[model samples]
Target: MSRKLLKLKGAFDLRPWYQRNDYLGWIMRAKRDATKVRRLQQMLDELRAGDAYMNMAWRPRR
Candidate 1:
């Protein structure tokens, strides 16, 4: 069986095995997006914690 090599932008080309495998691309993209989502969630949690602390600190004592 003959397979065409996919030319990559940098230097190396995609091997026949990778060229034939379709899910690898989707999995890579999903993993990247998942990482981004995790980072965003952590930042959001930090911001919320800071906001709550500021609110408590600004309250006047009776």
Candidate 2:
């Protein structure tokens, strides 16, 4: 979990464990600098929004 994202009202913790784990592995697997940055940005955006994961619609646990 990102310290910055963690500061956002448990945004990282809000995600499913599988999503978090898989995203880390997927993001770290990027071979290009731009790809890593893009994936990371997408992750941050998704986490911040709390309404989507990997560009797919998602509803948080209520």
Each model's lDDT comes to 0.34, 0.84
TM-score winner: 2
Model 1 ranges with Cα > 4 A deviation: 1-31, 51-62
In model 1, the worst 10-residue window by lDDT is 4-13
All candidates' TM-scores? 0.32, 0.81
lDDT, candidate 2, at 27:
94
Return model 2's CA RMSD, one decimal.
Answer: 2.9
lDDT of candidate 2 at residue 49, scale 0 to 100: 80
Q: Give the TM-score of candidate 1.
A: 0.32
What is candidate 1's local distance difference test score?
0.34
RMSD of each: 20.7, 2.9
